[model samples]
Target: MRFGPETWSYASLERVSGQLAGALRSRGVQNGHRIGLFMTNCPAWLAWFFAISRVGGVAVPMNPAYTGTEISSILEVSDLRVLICEDRLASRLDSPPKQPPSVDVLMTSRTLQVNGPAEMIEHAASPDPTAPAVIFFSSGSTGMPKGIVHSGRNLVRIVQTVSMTWPLRSADGLFVAMPLAFVYSSIVECLTAIRVGATVELQERFDPDATVARLAAGKITSMMGVPSMYRMLLATREQPGESGKLRFCATAGETLEPALSHQFGERFSCPLLDFYGLTEAPHIIAHSNPAEILERPLSCGRVLTGVEARVVDDHGQSLPSGETGELVVRAPWMFDGYFRDPTATKAVLKEGWFWTGDLARQDAEEYVYIVERKKELIKRSGFNVFPAEVERVIREVPGIAEVAVVGVADTFLGERVKAWIVPRPGVAVNVEQVLAACRAKLASYKVPDAVEELQELPKGPTGKIARKELRH
Candidate 1:
């Protein structure tokens, strides 16, 4: 694995992971204990993740950009016993009022580097296949993020299935620029490469210039990114050398526009394959077959082996081909459930099928086309941002009377958060103040890109905010 200026072999990585697991055990970490990982993409991130799993503890991967409030909410729900965070990210957890005191903080620089006795300590046995292994928090419609738990067996099955589908050779090198906290990177980039014994080129964060330089140097064979990352890379002047080592470029986390796909393919001389899946399922249900990208440019491609996908209506009845409806999927590697949220879990999962809020249509040829999101979720630059979450944050501002958050189309970010506010009588509210409040309490992406003052918010007959009207 390569991260920035350092590279490590598989043997070295395993040794580090084993030592870290031993260190964690020395600090009272026990099997089935919940551990949080809040750090940027780097070697230590994977080392800590593997260490937690090595000792049979549940790993909770959280976005490093989360603010104190966001992190506190996750801690409240996840019941994390220990949080291994990067030195820089640990400062965000210092806010006294909202800081989680119950959770112990272990700096990655210090904790992960601590060496145990040379005598190797035997790690805990692997948990059952059905045992919860990791919890990935995804934005929920109700403003709080939901922790989706995936079993050890589920993760293994996903990696095995994906390896079979797109068999990566041992010599192949996979580039991972996206954050590992997200399921897309965790499963597709990190675990999949490990399962196939392929090298992984890691980046602390996505930088178009650095990534393009690596591609030009022929350092990576395949890369995975979101739509925004691809766009940035295409905008760069750097071009891949004629070596033709970089073969595949896979995109997920957002709808891949056809124009962007075409431009990327033409510029990089590589197939820009798009995949469709969610944190709940944690694997690509539909993907563009490398060989058939030219034939089916718009389709996300057919479902993979052992995965069932159907377009169903509001009543859960399957729709005919070419009819748009909610996409429901049943897969062997689906998540166990939302951690500590059985009510929310039951709402989406039923009868062994996950009701993906995404709307899609499948053609007669079994190719899937993502239409739109039926849920009130906003995807800004591939990060799920719930409208309610932004609305709730905006409402906390003193000058706001009522607020509504909606996503506006953007050429670069796919969608940008836009807030409309209703000011109280005789009280002046400015965009700067509202944005300042958001920046203090929310992540950078969750902050509204634009704010507009409204005389009064439009409401439906039921006296609720008319979000659809605001979109128009």
Candidate 2:
């Protein structure tokens, strides 16, 4: 694994992971115990994840950017036994109402130390394939996010499916800029590269200039990022670097506009393929073939071999090809369920299919084209920004009578969070004040980029706010 200015050979990573596992065992970590990983994208993050999995502990990856309130909710729901967090992120847990699980703050400067033995410790085999292995939080439309659990078998199956579909060669170098906490980055950029024995170039965060320089230096062969990252790269006015070696760039987490895709291809002289999936199924559901992008620019391409996708109506009846409807999918491997939330899990997972809250259409050739989101979830810069979650935070601000959050189109970010507020009578609400309050409570991406003050927001006959009308 190669992170800017530092490279860890496979052997070195294995040794560190083993030592970390030994340390975890000595600290009394047991099989099935949840271990929270709250850190940025770094070598230590990966090492701790492997160590936890090696000791049969379920890994719960927490977004390092989450605020104290957000992190507290996850800790309460997950009931983690141990938390391995970077020193910088540990401050977020300083004032939890209830004391959180035992935390082991880690620094990059120190190597993992083992007291008794540094020898490799084999993991106990899980008797059931469905046993929980990892927990991921999905933005909730109602309010708080739900924890999606995946099994050990699900991880192996997703890696295998991705390796077969993309088929990266050992000589290739993969560049990853997306957050590792996101399932897309973890599966496509990390595990897939490891499976193919390809070198991974990790970036702690996306920087357009640094990314372009690496590509120009011919240090990376393939790159994976979200639509926003690609837009940033296209926005740069600098001369295109030595990009001839870049084979292709894959994008997901939000819709990839055909115009943006065209502009990126024209600028970089490489195919900008669209990838589509969700946290429920971490593996790519559909991906555009690099060679066929010109012919099928709008499509997300064919579904993977082991995956079944269909456009269905509200009744779960399959819609014919070329018709827009909800996209339902059944894959060989998928998330087990929403942790401790059988009600929510049952709502989406029916029989053998998972009903994705995405409106899409399918061509006769089985290529999927996303239309719009059926849910009220806002995706800004590849991160989920739940309107309700933001509203809950913003509603507490003084002089705020009511607030409604929606996603507005953006050239660079695909969609940015926008809030419409109706202030209380005789009180003045400033946009900057509302934003300042949100910045303290919500993640950076969830903060509203624009705020509008209205005497009264548009409402439907039922007296509920009409989000669709506000969107227009």
Candidate 3:
């Protein structure tokens, strides 16, 4: 893994992880204890992760960008025995008026480097295959943060499934700039590459110019990002010929519309593949075929191997092909359950299936198309309006960088469609143009009743557009 000026081979990572594991055991870390990794994307993050796993500790990765209140709330819910963070962020753990509850030990990058014994080795049995080993927080969550737990074996299975679906070999090099606190970056991209001995270039946070330079110089052969990341990268100016040696680029954590895919492919001369997944099941659960998506727009590809997916009604009865309903899936690598929330767990994990709360449908050929979140379905004038459908149409409008459609209360219409749009930097957006595009492709009721523009939309930890905040 390469991060800034530092590079680490697998051997170096194993040694650092071993040393950290010994230090953790010396500090009383034990089997089943929950530990929080509150840092950005770095080699230290992975080393600490493997170290925690080596000593049989459950690793809880927290978004370093969260506010003090948000961080405090996660701490309360995480049951973390130890919390590790960068020295710069460790001070914030004591943020005034709401200092986070103290864990058994709070280790920072500086402290860990200074205190770790250089020659110590880790000696512990592997964690239970069924026991929770990692807890990844879900996006679009309400109230306190919701962490989805998975066993070590489950993580292995998820990596294997994605690696097979999105083939990568040892010779491949990945450019990873997405947030590592989420599974898409940490497991789907990062761990998946490691599973095949592929090298990676890690970025603490995304910088479009830096990323463009890396791609232009052929520093990496593969890239993975969310739609927003790709949008920003595409917005940056680039020369025509100096493109990355990318065989393919994968995107997830949000809907992948055709307009963006075509623009991205044209800009970088690489095939952009879209995958669908949840925090509960890592990614590449379903992936897109370039030709199939063109033949059937918005298709999220077919269900992957070792996985069963069905679109079902509220009663859990499976709907026929071309029928829209809640998307429920069954997979061997699915998450164990939500951490310490059986009541919430039971609500979604019905019998043996996981209700994905996503409104979607399947074609006769088994191509899956996600419409929107079931909860985000906008009810307008007694007609069901899926926000994603409207948003998809709005995105086709020129100059629109991102858009979020929400349902605002209306005494007469029950809920009126309200669209929040963020235009490309330095570009002027015509609300009339947005409405016209929507009118052309969408039903009258599905078009935005009220339009508002913004510099940017609120995003969840996973980089998916957060409609919950806009609704509030």
lDDT of the candidates, in the order given: 0.82, 0.81, 0.78
* TM-score of every candidate relative to the true structure: 0.95, 0.95, 0.79
| Model 2 agreement with the true structure over 1-472: per-residue lDDT tens digits | 8887678877777677877777777778888888888888877777787888888899899887888888888877888888777776657778445335455444332233323254666664343667888898766777786998988889889888877777477888899877788877786578889888999888888988888888788788888788888889877765546556778678787766778887777777777777788889765455747655667776777788888988999999999999999999999787888999999999999998999899999888888888889998888888888899999888999999999999998878878889999999999988898999899878898999999999999999999999997786
lDDT of 1 by residue, 20-108 (tens): 88778878888789999999888888888888988889999999889888988888888888898889787788864465678888887
Clashing residue pairs in candidate 1, if any? none
Summing lDDT over every window of 10 consecutive residues in candidate 2, give the lowest-scoring window.
Answer: 107-116
In terms of lDDT, the best-performing candidate is 1
When sorted by lDDT, best at the front, the candidate numbers are 1, 2, 3
